[model samples]
Target chain A: MSEKHHIIQVWFFVGVLLLVYGFLILASGLAEWSHPPDIVLAELHAPVWWGALMLVLGLIYCIKFLPDRKA
Target chain B: MTAMMAWTVPTTLVHLSAVDLGIIAFYFALVLGIGFYLKRFANTGEDFFLAGREMTAWVAGLAFVSANLGSLELLGWAGSAYQYGILAAHWYWIGAIPAMVFLGIVMMPFYYISKTHSVPGYLQLRYGSATSALSAVTFAIMTILMSGVNMYAMAVVMKVVLGWNINFSIWVSSLTVGIYVASGGLFSAIFNEVLQFFLIWFGALLIPILGLIETGGWKGMVARIQQNFPGQDYTHAWSTLGRFQDNPMGMHWTGIVFGLGAVQAMGYWTTDFLVVQRVLSAKDIRSAKMAPIIGSFFKMAVPLIVILPGLLGLAVLPMHLVPASSLQPGQYSYNEVLPLMLARYCGPGLLGLGITALVAGFMAGMAGNVSAFATVWTYDIYRPFLRKTAPDQHYVSMGRWCTLIGLIVSIGTAYLAMGFASIMDYVQALFGFFIAPLFGTVLLGMLWKRVSRAAGFCGLLAGTLSSVTMFTLMKLDHRWVAIFALSPKAQGLAQDMYQALWACVTCVVVTVLVTLVTKPRPDEELKGLVYALTEVAQEGHTSFLHRPLFWGITALVILAVLQIIFW
Candidate 1:
């Protein structure tokens, strides 16, 4: 019998990438929350919000495009 | 304010922390992994050059748009927005959207059905080998040179922003792109481009979003721009196009509509192999047709990210920005707007992502150009001319080898550009010489049944020669610009437009005149290549929603609405 080969989707790769970046960024944001960096609108905590958004999006992509999952 | 002023002072505008470097390292590692993983599939010539022709519409579509969305384009257009105001949006909207739509609905069928490996391959089928050879050589040279220019530009950008050594930036990035692209061919390039697309959005979308918040939305931004640059129409797109001198871009409505929107955009989207190669990888006719339509949607939205940042910078930045030639110690140049905005807003982890996005864009751009160059060099030039009887595997190996060679040549070109920055301008002008006339020749060859092969070659030659002559004269004597541009006050942009228009006109005139005297190919011989001789493939009883034309029209409707909204 021929072995079945599974090709990974580009989105899966992107998901993993974004997820890793998100985690790192979110952790950085949390560490800086007590005393934010001196930047324009740093009070808004853009890293925290944007990083969380990226994490959620990445999670969604990773789930939807998992290698074993059927479309 | 110190960070905001970093662009002018420039002691390495921003430094990446450990986490930031991690993000960039992660990006490079992932792309290389994908490239190595895809290597097994790229076994044959077609697979290497065309990604096995199994890409879905969305895959090919994102790749198509992302291939053109290189870092140079992003920074250049964003900087244009600062220099020329809202008028820069014209390049995104009227200049790109319509051509993309037309390519999907009209041109893609011929390109797809012909089953050509590259744009020059299509020319060979339509206009004979002589014409194809010219385009192949020109395209191969142009792409390699363009790739080198982009490499040098990216190195300089990194040096200015991060205090990285130019040679270190150049070698490291080029090696990454070279390794990935050489291993996986078009597949690696396309996948990286798709990822780069998302990274660009994630990294850059914040600039406009935060800028809007700071400036209190679109109306506030426009008001602030008016206050900053009084008596100038920085916020108006089409209104300033009434007179050449009325706008900062110094362009007329006719030039915008005809020269850029009609000729240049059409030539690029419909004919340029760098972008078209992405579309050509779609799995089927329908997907191929749909790819550019999908790209058009993203192309239309690009202005929001690129153009909006420039407007935002004008609305809010504290430092006075001047043109590069007039830049002083305290003032930043227009080219530094995007980097300045990144420094002003992004911190730590987010800074890494921003820098990664720029690096990804640069690598993807280089990969795209090099891959396209390799394809042309292997299939169109090397295979056809040097070794026509090579096995498919041999050609695939040749393609891989050419990728490394192209990168080496590009690295050299980058140094040439660094030594003589004006050479970059000349290379760009050289590119412009071929685009309009090639569009004319290809448009005629595909549409008009009477365009003989000889006429095609002669027309292309005449058009190219005329363009070169015109550019040379304009360079030698400034007075020639007035005659070509139809007004003494016509600026550089206007001169480019009129020059393209004239070259296209010259091409068409020579083509018709020569076709009248030459022996036209019979309809039997011309089948599947010309519009009238070829039976067009119907998108075939798919749902109305699934039709490429339906979405193409939808894109056009949105385009019209955008023009009205931004009018």
Candidate 2:
């Protein structure tokens, strides 16, 4: 038999956290890019690309097993 | 964000508004809640100590590096960046990645499948009781002392950044870490550490980003630093590393590669129990192996959080703004870079979040150390010495007790760690004295089954004695380290690295020579302990692309590219 202990096992709390955090960070980046403010968003040199990266990873993680919850 | 109260460390404060205090309070409560909430999973000794052996690679991975990635790391190494420039990246790259990847690729099979609780427990199985006891005692002391150093770092950050009483900050931080760790054990500690890993990124992301933008990005920042520091090229890593005297830091290339990169890095990452215990708490053998691999990836990126701020500070903060205490006759307290950046860049809500990130780092660090101390004290020492056949419940109780004792001892030790020029260097010196010899001993014990119990014990004993003796000699007179460096300034860090390298050599030499003379342990006795004798439990089973070996190789390749690019 093949053996690969994938870390894709169901996570109870962490999964939800990833989903919320990912969505928030990803959305924040998108929002910032789309609607740049004169002053509120000024002085903010935040790494939106990094946030997108975090979001993609987070989405992949959450989407992989979010629907497959175990009792 | 700027409280223009004639800013000075210990006296000057961030003058946190209500929002900042609220965020910090909420963060502390959340951490404690997570700890107490996990008490259900920690009923048994295994659950309490090893998180029921169910740590996912991601969780364990983050916790693995986060254990060391505290304010001490972010603040101390950022200070290194401010003083030494991009060469500080070596600590994260060559100093950590190779050894960490090696642990995942080579050592984890033995560390995981054999099912040892602590590093000393592994030693006991391989080299017998005396060696294990010595390791356990030394490790326990190291963990407590290191935990104390974390405590001191937390206090200093508070005193400098927020202008709090150092003693009050230390006591409060210790109580918070002590409460969670004593209640939930490793489960709480690892969970909190993983949380902290994210928080630190969230908190400190602003400085480097804003600082770079402020200076007109990478090229601009480099130009600024060059202007500020006339002959020093702070942007490059490997180019300046060709010679110690060539660099502003007066460090040699040989010491960087051999002493810091090989011995000190391998010693701490591979052998030290603080980080190892996090990996051991992983869900399974493969996860244990994968944990450090994943940590290795983050470890590569971590310099961004810790080091970038320092570089940013170099290009941004004026020389006069640096505190008089931190600034010497010529040398500036580069240690103030992180605090200075935090104070200058972050505003209101973000400022509180940044402050919490650092506080969380210290808290996580204290928890990591206390948890490690408890495990060694319980598994390696108490179980073997106090009551050999005690109930698992009793051992868990002992672990909790040790957690309290460890935190208390650390408070005392934190007092000792103060006044050092760089917390990073002071910690490196500590690592050299203990970790360098231990790695030498463990390296021989694992790979060569011929290493006898007596040989291991005596080799470790002798190597340790030599490390202390060398330190004493160097402290007493410059004549002791005359061979290593011509001047006292060059002797600063180069001496520690050389001493570690020589001590490691001494341990290896002594262990080898002694093992050759002494009767060897039978192959049967070394059945899962020695590399040659042990069956690779999870080898060739993992998907080649997904396996730790694959990821470890991938990390090394990335590291090489980064080094060359930065060079």
Candidate 3:
């Protein structure tokens, strides 16, 4: 049982990785908010939208599968 | 196919921003981290090859689907959608769904209950060593060659899309995949594949979403297709398949049904060890059965991302894309549809994510193939043929070494692919030679107890040789498609279908004929491997929702609805 506890679930790692990526992308989105890149539908701000979506997803995973939580 | 596409684009498509590079770097770091973290657990041969058989249905199922979601398939099918219209969805639907359901409900029990480490290992139990040896060597060669093709293809795509040098892209990706797979084995590959499943979905999903938003809706897109290419039924799946000239793919309904839906699909989803190894890692018999059923659901949804983008490209791209045959300097081919779609809608950070998704796809594809090769090499080829009495630790060490050596061979093949582009087409066709024939052999071995050992080997040999002969004839004279496919106008895709169907038919015929003359394996020796002779574990009052059959039926119903809707 202790040996089982030593193994990290794949979801937890996915969560943490998503969280870091989400933060960086979200920051990039905000940084370019006033002057968005010249491309199709720049006004819609897809980076911000997709970045926030990733953030919420990451938080849900991280909270539910926190490494130290009792199984 | 993307593998057969010659890289002729002189100009780079897009340059990655620092944020984009960072996202890709983080993904690499995380995969490597997972591999090192799992190194302690992969100490035994079982753990290395099969993840200690402890994966949940969902994990195994996602990895199972993701193993085939290579960038080559994604890009190729997406490009095919652009070129062939909604008909390309047939590959995702009828070409896949039935085979997956059959695998889960009918085949998984035999594989799981027998406790076989690999598909060839199962063959060894049913037939004698000759059949298993043929299967193992063919599978190993196919996987290694395929891994190389994917490695080279990814490097070419990177150079075309991101301005990276081909050698740099090849070495970086191959070395990364090699390190992780060698260190953590199947566990690392599965974990990364599951992650890749998410990356592919999230990264590619926006195209369809944003594309739909731009094109209005399904109805609007259909209208645009009709408006753009008038009188061309690019929006219907089955309606245009009535005649050879009716559809862009130049395929008939019979080829679509028997060749693709029945033979090729069964051959691939049911028997390919590259994907089957994931299901073999399930925690229980139920999980093993449930895995492919779960995978079918996700596979059905892939067209929303892959096929939809290509259709959108047809409806919305500013310039007309040419086919690869007529492609020239500075001209974009249909194969560039996905990357072009990525550039059209994605901005800085999101662009990075999309590019990383493609990179993840390529790397994960290479990892899955290499890992499967290592398992087949260590267990089926190396141990059985060369050193039969080695310790478990010795085998595990050999698996790791084999993983590295396999990557080196794959890298060499990648260079070979660079020199001779036509080899990719031949290799892909050679792969086709095995799948449908092997499916026939495995199916007979499982269902028919009277089949002899000699019958299995002879049937497989005859089937493979016939496929080779047909491919060679078709290459030597294009008119051979008329003879093999029974139509003068049958295209390359049609030739593939007819070839697979004939090969499967030839195999079944030869096996039955040989079985009559040869001595059969005794019933006592065929217990767990053959169908009715085996004692299957009962589910024992399990809820209907918990049963694999229930989900299999549900998936089939959904598949029927999808075909009708797209029809």
Candidate 4:
């Protein structure tokens, strides 16, 4: 458990960073792609997908190795 | 959020939103914070230099490959893809996988057991002092030069993308990279590298994904590129391996297989300290061996991130964005491929992320080179001759100070790199001149105990000189073409490939000849250093799936399938 705690911190820190940036990009990408001032057909946009990736990765680290969960 | 946001090709603002700027700013702050956070823990030479030598397989493995995921591997190969089409994938596959797997299964045991501080240190132990000294000096210079090249390349990207001052970009990136690397040594740099690795993937991922989607898919992209650039072999790897002129790279299969795969790439993956230092810091021999194997898997897929953008550029980009480059052996302004794709595909916030990825890549490269330069300088150059029997802390201070000195030297070299047309060509020539010969000596020194100390020294020196002479003569071939029957000023991968082959051949021949005349080092003195004299490294006989040999063969098989399929 202690071993996991020590290793988890680095991943957690990176995860938090990614999630913060990722969520923002996702929100913005969704806003831009879905509600653009000029309406366009929905397609696989880069920012939205990439942002979701970060969000999921961030959630994994934050959930699995959350500070409260530290052994 | 705007009324009707019209978009054109971005030259200055880079299409990055305010949120994007904040994201990038936060990343830089976190990186610096990590450096300072680890500073106090790095009091000892070992901690500062080797991450306290308690790293797990994952740490060492990621660091092993991430340290190499530098600006050159990112931008240089992408640029190559733009010019050479799918032929550029060879560098990532055949050029890397074999040597890397070989290093894991065969060489990691010696490297791990010896406890040598640096690659040159091993040469000292095996061959003799003179060989080590020569290698140390040469490596120290090469490492700094590489860092400077990264600095220059990054500055060019910044200037092109953001219209920032080149000097300002160089100084800021170099100083930032130097501070963290000097502060936490390999530890900080490597941890950040793991982070950089993720960021690089996340950042560069958009280009190919969005590109493929926009172009329909792989088949659609191939068809579009064929339609756009008719009569060009733009989508094959192995089929183009027939001859030099068959491929766009003007390189033959022999050059690809022997020169790049055998000599240039092998020299870098197996012998270069920049990558080896990461492997050396592993916790156990298995981890050390497994690190490169794991890295080889990653290495095989790297072309997707770096090369795919250039290929995508062929299909999607308009005529003006993809300029025709007059640069030798290449016919495209592929350097712009990454930035152009980033600007085109990434809308707002992702643009910042993409740009940050590019920045992180360059910074990671700089840190890799500087950290390696610092290690080689302190252990090989400073401790050996400058100040002997110094306190651990004293050497640690020397390392930190030397990190600064290495950066200053790199700044000067950054200016020199600005003069080159293709940075990869220049770097490969350096590998040929320095690394190929060094690999020759190391390969022989490890495999054959009969290789005398004098022979190792003479061979390394002869190898370096011979490579330089070949490069010089290759350049001057245009003048004396009729007399020497020489090919003139070989460009792209072709000229460098042939040059490296000749140099490696000369190095091996000279080393063998010199070794034959000299007395062999006795078996008693060669323990743990020479393969024949040392105890065989069993790797404890793991399962078929777990064995390094198994993974190696699997990797080669996958490579063969990819080649035939792509061909």
Candidate 5:
């Protein structure tokens, strides 16, 4: 693929990632508003779980969109 | 004459035997020596402002932790833990870790790529010069107010614990900091911060380990707390999983978690030049990235050292000693309660000296702020506008002069802060008034591509207005007589949670919606930001997964869950 095409693809992936995380934040807010199951709320609030999820998603997004090794 | 005489009384001790005077003079000489020793490294503007961007990860990391662990946090958290039970740990667990992670992984790359000496510099690149100048001025004002209060708190502790007069303490503390900071610039500030990191950690740890042992160990302390404050909800309160309603003292868990936690976390971790200067001064991107994350490891343990002792103090000390009456009406002064505990419990000799070192630790934190304020004002605001062309030495000299001026202004601010009834209230009010608006602008500038310069500036103004309006309403409504009498239990909790809830909701909603409606910035400027974000992954040597984002989120979730269950 051409360099221009690659840059566009990277932008597309970033857009997706932002959307997904924004959705998660919205979900978390709504979940709190709706007062979800006690177990779910408990899990949702844990820094470990939320931190892990955000990290995993962020890493995957960064790696996929902005690869370390130049082709 | 009585008040004037009261001030001079503390100065009399300065004329005491040569030995006592020597110790004070020795302290001054040592600090100045460090400043002068580091002066060679600060020959340039970059070095003076940012240590020539050569600080190692470990130094940056430790300095970051030390700078944030001010006396206010040490004293405030302890008081909070004493009043609210263990659930107060959520402040560190839920608030600090996630914020640091977000800052490191997501926000920091923008800073690294922009290569801005100040956060406002980044604003200029991404938005426009107008927004940048506005932000620089706003931040300087906020730093002056916040650092002033922090300085005042340290002076207050010295006055209460050592029986020194307040004005004398302020003068001594301010001058000691001014001399080193003005001479050394960021170099001395970072060096002193490293020393203070150890001092604060050692001082904070000494209180709890010694206090617990004195009270018969953790089990004995726990038993005493349970016995005295039965059904006080220690388990839920201490746990990381608890909600806003979980705190018995009625501190709004959500408001603190989000408002102070998320908002102030964004302000301090992302925007504040003081914290950002540490990262910007790093040897490389990897060091900058790793420093705050590693620093957070220390921050995670700070509550154990600082807050736990206050909770332990509740069990060991008398009710009158840690009396609720000491707190001003409609205000919480829990931060003051810790030093009071030290004066009562910790005997003189090495133990007293160690606690005195803790007071120094707090001073070190305030000194770091003074150094940062001077650096930002001198390099970003003053030099840019006033003296556009100058040699590196000239800028460095100006930085030193700015440091002295900054210290004097902050000392005056601290004296004024004394009029406010509660330390935490004054600190929070200042933060909310100034930073809440800036948070919106910076956050939008970083994340949203579509936010225009006009919108960014407008959103900032709107967020500030919203925050001030909410704060005013809360203050006014709090004064009106209640229609019906509520139990003391209900009243306390309501008051604790109210301010945090209003501030968070108002700031977030106003900033986001306003930015969305406003036009986007010119595409050319934003394109660079986009390219930089994409390139950031390639620039840093460390693996992406090793980023603190994963660990931070996990920790935040675990702590939040624990807080909820415990609450």
Candidate 6:
């Protein structure tokens, strides 16, 4: 593939990853909605660990696939 | 209790006079000295306003921390801890770290990529001059409102601590900041901020330490809290999710974590020129990028300095000593609690002056905000439209003039804002209403190639209007409920989180959808657009969107996980 096309694909992939991550959060919140964590854990509110994992995966994709400046 | 053991209020002004004056003089001399020392740097517009873009990351980092660490926070956070238990920390955990990292890694890169002198200048390059002007005007108005509130906070602190007339306190605090800012512009502002940061840190730490010792140490204090406030969950008190309803002290984790953390984070870290100006004024992209990261690390430690003391005060003092009204339901002005504690507890000696330094710490924060407003107006607004080709010296002179104008405007605004609940609350709510939506437009314009200027402008207008509509509706609903004798808690969680969630979502959706419909700009205009991102290049990266992108993303994930586990 051409360079421009490759760059476009990378961005598209990253967008998909973010969308998935958002969905995961929505699901977790739904699962926990009825039985809210105790006040201690409730203050945590969202699933930060899952969020962190998704963020990490997204970062890895960016590192491997995203374009760098050409000298 | 024996008469000798009973607490007695100081009956004579003579006891407080020397220490109070000494504190005032110390503050005046330090700020003024900074202003004078940096006078030569203010010989030109760039130097006066942007520090000639020569600031290192460390300087920018320190200044950024100092700018945000105002008295409101010093007072508010401590009040929060005392009232809410540990859950109050949710404010710092949820809102601060994530938001700041987003700014440093994501937004800062965009600014560096744009190579714009000011945040509004980036808007101009991406959208058009009109949009840029609108953003600048919006920021200026919001900043004025904010600085006014900050001024009020300083005035109130001074009034309560020293018994000065409110008007006199406002003038003295506002004018002292104005004089230095007017004298040396950003240079003096930064220099003074560095000094203020140290003073604020010292003062914030000292009060809690002293109070803890006086209360018979941690064990005694903990026992007192347990005995006095029964059924109070210790874990919840320290938990990040603690809500205001949970604490008799009137602070809620929801407001601190979500409201202050998410909303304030987006507003201040992303949009506020005062903080962003520190990064923009850096000598290069690397320094700019590093500033917020380092500054945020420093911000993380502030709880130790500010919050612990308030908690300590709550433990040591009797209910009779602290009036019931002061700790009334839903009326904890965390800011007032500190000075009140000091007045009640501090004895005649050097320790008294040290506590006075906490007041100075508060003043320093106010000064930073004042100077920031001055810089934004002078460089982004005045110089652009009023005098296009003015000499450097003339621009520098204008900067000083602008600083004076900012101070005067802020003082007037501060006096007007006092009737509102808490200054910090008012400022944060106002910022959410005004500035948060703008972040969406700016972020899209920088990252996406298809986002047109017209689309960006339309998106901004739509996002802002929608967010405001939602906010108004929520307020109206709350008011109606109150009229019907309904409790605030009955209004529901959605109403509370409405402003932050919708404001962020609306801005993103509007910008994206509008961009999809609009035609992209011509290729020629887009040539240099990507260069700003490229100039701050990673050596090992083979393309524009390489390792740094992933590194930033990975960092976000780690942060999220940590938040989940610890928070």
What ordering of candidates by lDDT runs from best to worst? 3, 1, 2, 4, 5, 6
| Model 1 Cα shift for residue B47 (angstroms) | 0.6
**Model 4 bad stretches (over 4 Å):** A1-9, A34-43, A66-71, B1-13, B320-332, B479-490
Per-residue CA lDDT of model 3 for B1-567, tens digit only, reads 122223434566666677987898899999999999989988888899999888889989999999999876667678778877887788788889999999998898899998999999999889878888899998888888788777766875676677666777777788889999999999999989988888888789989988888889888888888888787777889988889999877889999899989998899899999999999999889899999999999999999989999999888888777665677777677767888888888888888888888888988889999999999988888878899997899999999998989988887776654443222233436556988899999999999999999999999889988998998899799889889987877766677888999998999999999999999988989999999798887876999989989999999999999989888
The candidate with the higher DockQ, 1 or 4, is 1
Which is the better candidate, 3 or 5, if ranked by TM-score? 3
Error (Å) of candidate 1 at residue B234 is 1.2
Task: Name the best candidate (by lDDT).
Answer: 3
Residues B472-520 of candidate 4 have per-residue lDDT tens digits of: 8766655532122123323546777776777777878888999899888
- Provide the clash count, candidate 6: 23
Per-residue accuracy of model 1 over A1-71 as CA lDDT, tens digit each? 00122457888888887788888899999989989887899999999989998998899889888776452
Q: Clashes in each model (backbone N, CA, C under 3 Å)?
A: 0, 3, 0, 0, 43, 23
Error of 1 at A70 (Å): 11
Candidate 6's error at B98, in angstroms? 2.1
Q: Write the per-residue lDDT of candidate 6 for residues A1-71, one digit (tens) a residue.
A: 12211112223243334334433433454465566543222433333343344456556665675655651
Which candidate number maximizes DockQ? 3
lDDT of 6 at B561: 64
What does the lDDT read for residue B389 in candidate 2? 99
TM-score of each: 0.95, 0.89, 0.95, 0.92, 0.76, 0.75
lDDT of 5 by residue, B259-375 (tens): 556675566566777777887877777677777877777777787776687777667765523333455443325555676555543322222333444556656766778777777
Clashes of 4: 0
Say what the interface RMSD of candidate 6 is: 21.7
Candidate 1: where is the Cα deviation over 4 Å? Answer: A1-6, A69-71, B1-10, B325-331, B415-431
